[model samples]
Each structure stands twice: as C-alpha cells, then as structure tokens.
Target: MELTPEYYDKGEYIETDTGNKVSRKSVIHGSQNIILGGKTIIQTGTVVRGDLRRSGTAHAVVIAIGKYALLASRSVVRPPSKVYKSIFSYYPIKIGDFVHIGEGSIVEAAQIGSYVQIGKNCVIGRFAIIKDCTKILDNTVIAPNCIVPSFSVYGGSPGALIEELPECWSQVMEKNAKIYYSMFTPK
Candidate 1:
C-alpha cells in the first residue's frame, strides 16, 4: 500500500541520531524505560506509559518498540498489568519491527510480532499475543489473554480469526511500513 505524504511542523518533533522521529506533543512517561529501535515514528497525541513497573524493580524496560514501527496519533501503548500470586506487576510490551498501529488504538499486549498492522480505534486486550504478519481491522476489540496466530486476519468485538493471509503478506506489510515512514515529512 502507498501512503500519502503526511506533513508536520519541524519544530513539533525531535529526530534522534538513529532516525526515530518523536512528536513533542506525545506523552511519554518514564522515557528511560522505553526503547525505540531506530527509524520509528511516534506521532502526536500518542501516550507511551513506561512509568508503570513491577514493584521493587528500579530500572526495567517497560516498552520496547522495534525499528520502522509507527505509532499513529492518539494511540496509547501501555504495559499490561496483572495480579499473580497476590503480587501485582506490570509486564513489558514488545512490539516487533515494521509494525503499524493505527490512530486512536489502545494496546496493552504482551507481544506484537513483526510486520503486523493494527487498524484504527482497536483495543488490544491485556497480555494478548499477536503473532507475525497479522492484521487487525478497525474498531476491533480483542479479548484478554487471546493468542492471535501468524498470517491471520482478526476483526470485530472479541476479535476472532477472520481469515488467513497469503505468503506475500509479510513482504507487503514490510514495504507498506517503509513507505509510510518515508512519506512522513517535515514541511
């Protein structure tokens, strides 16, 4: 897919040495605990919560987003938290390379694999595992503790496997993600 150019005010963003572009308007808490793996774009109004952590852990990574990932405007990326053995702790969120999270989505997934595309206004439930090369359509609500398989398409409330993707899905997703990144320009 080819994305149109998205223009932004140069002063509204900061480009890191590794080519990650982060919007100043984004709310990123505990920045030291969040890692962007170069060439990622964090758009305006996005909230990345890295402040929530396991009790007694002083310096732990809460969110790790991989290279060429895109977090669209108004999206929220938060670590999933749960009570286990009477202990409540927030687990880390691992987003893989070439992933694209669409606008207004809220993600609290344990792991999101590479080359995945999550459409607008989606809710990824806590501790949900989304495998590689999958697509979650817009307005979908994934159930907690769900495991989405690789090369599948999921949609609707309590997101179910809609269909299986072709072998070329990975290549297509990768290409689209790169194009989207390249087209996000300062004007």
Candidate 2:
C-alpha cells in the first residue's frame, strides 16, 4: 500500500517516551494549561486553545486529553465557555482515553468520556457531556448542555441519539486507536 506524504512526514512532531506524538504545526496555546496522557496523537493543523482560563483562576487547566487519544488533522479542541449571571468563564475540556476526534471538527465540550469516536466536521457545543463508548457520526452539530449517554450513536444537527452501540464498543475503539498510534514514525 502506498502511503501519503502525511504518513511519512518526518521532523514535524515531538514524540515523547510514552508514544505521544504532537505535531509541530499544531497550535497549542498556553501549553502549561494542557495536560496530555500517554500515546496521544495531535496531528498537523490541530489547534488546542488553553489561553481561555476560568474565572478567578489564574492557573486553571483548559484541556485534559487522556491516554491513547487521537486529535486528527485540522481539528480544534477548545474549552467550553458560558456566561453565568453576568460572569463569563471557560470550562475545561476533559477527553477520556481511546477517544478519536476526526478532522476539521470543533470540540467545545466540558467532558467526553472514554472510547468515544467523533466524526469529521462535527461541532460539539459548550457544556455537552458525552458519556463512554459513544460514536458521533460525521457533520453532527451537538447543542450546548446536551448529555449523551453511554453506548449510543449520536448524529445530525442538535445531535440526537440515533442508535445503540455494541457492548464491545470500548474494545473496538481501543484496538483501532492503538493501531493508529503505532503507525506514526519519528521524524
């Protein structure tokens, strides 16, 4: 099989000992506010905004991505923001292990649980809490404060629950994410 230039793209990322590959081209604002677990891949053109801090907290974390998580190319992962009683604040984005966020998607959710698969061009709104083992189909627009349950497939504008996931969904996500993480080579 012929691989694309992206696959062979060397010297464009910083690979840690735990196999976390973060692209040099990706924009990570306030790196101190971002915590990445092991084996996480942040692809080229991905933007992680951590400069938006919470109210009254100078050193608050903005994005906490879990182990074996993959942030695909051109995706933007930002903390969710809201106005509370005339006060504006940004909440942390907590993504669990084995999560795959597809290309061009914008994630502004408060929490995304383990084994979640978010497809391309999706919009995860502010304060949306996505439970474990959920699959979000392509082009879906999840509204603010939506609580997505576990083992379900969510899609479409406003993000309705479309179907139920199989019991082994977590295993499947783990397998695929591991494979993807292993495919990256050191530049």
Candidate 3:
C-alpha cells in the first residue's frame, strides 16, 4: 500500500512486521511496497523511484533497512540497474543498523554497513563494499567495488583516508541492532 498524502507533520509508514516508510512531505511514485523483518524510514522530501525499470511487470525495490536506520530527506534509492549489461535484471540494496543516510545522496546496488554515515550529495557507486564503522564525509565518491577499510574516516577528492573511526561507532551500531530486535516481541 503506497501512501501519498498532500502534507503531513510527522508521517509514518508501518508494515505488518515493519518495513519502509516515506514521510508525508516525501513523494513516492509507483507501487507501494513495505519491507519486512526490518525497519526503514524515509524522511520528508524524499523521492523514491519505484517503477524505473518498465519491465512489463511491476518492478519493486528489494532488501530492507535494519530497524532504527534513518534515511534522511531527499535521498534516492531504487532497484539496482547495470549501466551496461548483457542481461538486465533487478539487484537489491540492503542497509544495516544504526545507519544514517545523509540528505540528497544517490545510492544504488550497494551493501551498506552498520554504523555507517554517508555524507550528503555524494554518489555510492554500483556494487560497492562499505564496511562497518566507516564515516564517509559529505561530497565523497565511493567507487565501484572499492573495499572501504572498516573503522576509518574517509574524506577528500579521491576518498583518501582521514583517520581511525570514532571509538563509539562499533558500540553504537550494536546497541541499535539489539534495540531493533526487541521491537519484534509482543507487548
């Protein structure tokens, strides 16, 4: 079920078992799909392109974001499509826990790690490996298939290594994941 409200103060999309939610100010165009086993929330002003493939049948985005994973407003997430490929099919995008996705960024065909913060207006290349506790500052490019060494701060034009990641990154992600699991229990 897709929700298109004109304007809402604080909008929430909840699944039977919890999934993706795009806020009221956000524009989601296509078949409404909610994920399960995890929680993913799209904040205000976000635009999710669901039917970009046009493959005769309905095309939906695969994967889910772990609970407490917040996707800031204006972020773009769509089904993975190869720029050039012999066979065209959909690839899924998976986001882990305690993850903070910055505003106005483009992410596709990537497996983001837990406790990862991706800066705004940056591009996460297709098929990238983002390890845990990595802080990718704003305006950086995560190259395709590039292995981001875990527990580091990466910043600069070509993504040069900055320093060791914050000591709290690991602890924070773990806590987020645990709290998320607790939501599944019955009251």
Candidate 4:
C-alpha cells in the first residue's frame, strides 16, 4: 500500500499505550497537532495533513481522532478548507471513535461521529458533519456543509439517505473495528 516499510521493520513508530498502530508509510504532517486517542490504525498510503493548521492558533489540533478509528490504505484525511473573510483557512477534522474510513477515501469533514463506516473510494466533502451509526456506501460523494443524521445509510454521487441503520449497528461497528486492530500485522 505504499507505506514506509522501514519504520515498521525498525519499530520506529511510537506504539502508544493504547495500542495505536500507525504505519510509517502514512504521510502525517505536524505530528504535534494530531491527536490519536487509542487503538487507531493509520494504514499504508493514508495522508493526514495536520500542517494545514488553523489560522492564528498554535495549539489548535488540525486532526483529532478518537479511539478505534481505522483509516484504510490510500485514504486522505485532511482538514476542511475554506475562504474566510478574504483569507484562506483550514479547519480541524474531528473523527469520533469506531469510525472506519475505507480505502482510497477522501475525508475533509468537520466532524465524523462514532460507529460510522465510510465505504471505499468515497469523497466526503468539506464541513460535512456525519453523526453516529451511519454507513456511506462505496463511491459515494457527500456534498459540502451537509449534516448526516444518526442511524442512517447514505450513498450516491451527492449522497442521499437511503435507509435507516439497524439498531445493533453500534455493537457491530465496534466489534469490527476491534477485530481489524487485533488482526493487523506489518509485513
């Protein structure tokens, strides 16, 4: 998946006390401004741009990820960009726990709640607020500034609510995330 294999071999990554397995192959800028809660897997080819820091704030974390969040291969998780009062700026991207972003997805969301599963090759637009227990199918393109309600299933070019998520989705998502973390091994 195009990760820096040497880091895994050399064990250079700081394996956090919370069991976060971050691949060295992932392009993560501004490490100090990125917070990974625990048990988060940053897979190969994932690009998390924390260097696009918020304007005028040194302590602002560009990306704050919660526990058990999985960023799959080639996924790009960047802060949402915008032009504010004639100045271009990038806002922080907050991802909640148990959120699974699939391979090749691009997420520039304002917030992603817990137990959300974003399918492969999806494009989550800027300022999109995705709530808990939601599933976005493959190749879906969510529009900017849209709010995705909880317990919903969304898919399409401009993302539409297709159905309601099952009541037990939270448990299922959590279980899957845990399994993925447990099974991950560097080659």
Candidate 5:
C-alpha cells in the first residue's frame, strides 16, 4: 500500500546526513548508547531509553534501530530488564531494517526482525522476540519471553498467532516502509 505524504515543520525535526529524521520533541535518553541506522525516522513524542544498560557495562548500546525503521508518535522504546542470579540488569533492543512501530506503542522487545509492522497502542513485553515479516495488530499485548515466528500475524491480549503471511510478505513490508519514509517530508 502507498502511504500519503505527511509533512512536518522543518524546524520540528533534524535531518541527519545519513537521512535520519528525528523529531525535536522526541526524548532520546543517553544518545551515545543509541544507534540509529541510516534513513530511520523517529516521530514526535517518541521516547527511546538508551540510558538503561546492564550493570557494570559502560559505553554499551542499549537501543539499535536499523535502516528505514519508523518509530511513530508517542511510542516508547525501552530496554528490557530482568533479575538473574540476584542481579538486575537491562538488555539491549535490536530493531531490524524496515520495521514500523506504531503510535502510542510501548516496546521492550529484545529483538524485532526486519520488515515487521507493529500497530498502535500495543504493548510488546520484555524479552519478546518478533521475527521477520511479522505484523502485530493494534492494541495487542504480547507476553514476556514470547517468540513470534516469521511471516506471521499476531493480535489480541497476550498476543497469539493469528495466521501466516504470504511468501511475498517481506517484499511488501519492505516496500511499505520505504514508501512511508519517502512520504514523510519537511514542509
């Protein structure tokens, strides 16, 4: 599907040399610990918490977002944390290329594979792994430690696998992400 052009005020965003469009209103904590791959877009009010890291680890990345990924308005990307052997530590979040995290969503997933689309107001639990070419529908709540396979559609509370996607789903999702990024223009 072709996305319509969405314009933003030129003063409201910073366009990096690598084509990353980051909104000025977004709260990105610990910038040094966050890596935004070329052509990524972070929209208004998005919060990326890169400050949370494993104990005793310095100069470690907490969030890594890949190319053409879109973090929509009001979305929150936080590192997943857990207590292991009497130690509490946060883990890194790796978001692959061409992923779209929708508005108002909160993601604490350990990994999100390429060409994935996550819908609005969803809660992706800590350490959940969403594989390539998956679509998570709106308002879903994924349970912690859940493993979502590739080419699947998941929805509902405690997000269950709804159905399998077609073989061409990766291509379709990649195209969609590209279109969305291209259409996001500065006015």
Candidate 6:
C-alpha cells in the first residue's frame, strides 16, 4: 500500500537537549509502532514500533545507524520484514556508517556495511549482507541471505559478483580498520 507523501503531515520538530530533530508531521507514535512517513525525520536515540503496514506479514523494528550516519531525506527504514512488491514494503533494515541508500529502494533483513552505496530501487532481500565499500547499481535485486564480499560491485538480480571496484582495495585507514573510511583504505 503506497501512501502518498501528503498523507503524512509535517509538524514542528522533535527537539531535545542534544540535537535530535524529529519532524512533528512524522509518525513518532501510534497504536503499535511509531510509524514514520514522508517529511518524517527521526533522529538519534529515537525508537518507533507499532507493527504498522498491511502486508499480512511479520515485521520487526530495530535501532540502527552509526553515531554519525545520516538517513537521507525520504528514506524509510523500520524493522526487518519482506517487501512483496515495489508498491510498498519495508523491513528489518540496518544501515551502517557512511552509507548512501539511493531512491525508492526496498530492503528486508539486510545489513548494509559502511561506505556502501546502494543505487536507486534496489530490492535487497532478507539475509543479505552488503559488505563494505560495495556499489550496487540501480534496480538490482540482491536475493535473501546473500553474502557479498567487501569492495565488490553488484549489478544484477540474483546478483553477479565482479571485480569493478574503486581504489580502496589496497589502502588502509589508521583508526578504524574494519570499514572503508578513507579512499586509500582497502576493503
């Protein structure tokens, strides 16, 4: 069920002592979970759950995002649940640090690593592991539970593993070694 952007009204702002700015128009509280819609800007330390949506499916909400991770405008993330169609679906989603999830992509039970760029309209299924520094092009379907190695470029449904990566494969970062922080760091 695709709800139009206008359905969600933007309110003042959920401000706090720190700097978490949650949009008033967004769904921060409900009968079950705190449902967020367009114009909804949830900040750090915020948690929402009501098991909203009409999927006849099970959904699980999780607290995600790194200390400095920014969930871009119009990005919808909730708990892990299977999105049956492109029309409307959100799931257990864990977006890592410095990740860029492009437009209108649907995800379920997916763990996107740091520095990962999932292009527009990606169908990342349950149990999918998008490793660090990987660039998934537009309209790709990463099947359920797929384990992608770090620094790879995937561009097809059922996914095709190739070696077309940026130059972060051989370099190293001094402080954080697990993620691809600097351009010189290897995956």
For model 3, the local distance difference test gives: 0.65
- Give candidate 2 misplaced runs (Cα > 4 Å): 1-6, 55-58
Q: All models: lDDT? A: 0.94, 0.89, 0.65, 0.88, 0.94, 0.52
TM-score of model 2 relative to the true fold?
Answer: 0.93
Report the backbone clash tally of model 6.
18
Give residue 63's lDDT in candidate 6 (0 to 100).
38
Q: Which sections of candidate 6 miss by over 4 Å?
A: 1-61, 81-93, 167-187
Model 1 ranges off by over 4 Å: none
lDDT string for model 6 (60-136, tens) is: 34435543233333445545555465655554455665555555665553587766766777777776888877777
Task: Tell me which of candidates 2 and 6 scores higher on TM-score.
Answer: 2
RMSD of each: 1.0, 2.5, 6.8, 3.9, 1.1, 10.7
Clashes of each: 0, 1, 0, 2, 0, 18
**Per-residue accuracy of model 3 over 1-187 as CA lDDT, tens digit each:** 0122223243254333555444667676664442423465567777665555535655455655666665677887665567455766656667777777778877774588778878887777777778889888898877776778889888766676888976888786657544543343222
Worst 10 residues of 1 by lDDT: 52-61
Report the C-alpha displacement of residue 129, candidate 6, in angstroms.
1.0
Which stretch of 10 consecutive residues in model 4 shows the poorest summed lDDT?
A: 1-10
* Candidate 4: Cα lDDT at 29: 87
Model 3, total clashes: 0
Ranking by lDDT: 1, 5, 2, 4, 3, 6
Clash pairs (backbone) in predicted model 3: none
Residue pairs with backbone overlap in model 5: none
For model 4, residues 28-138, the per-residue Cα lDDT tens digits are 888888999999988788999988876675667889999999898899999998998998888888999999999999999999999999999999999999999999999
Error of 5 at 154 (Å): 0.4
TM for candidate 5 is 0.97
Total colliding residue pairs, candidate 4: 2
The better-scoring model by lDDT among 2 and 4 is 2
For candidate 5, write residues 1-187 as lDDT tens digits.
3399999999999999999999999999989999999999999999999999986646998899999999999999999999999999999999999999999999999999999999999999999999999999999999999999999999999899899999998888888888888899988
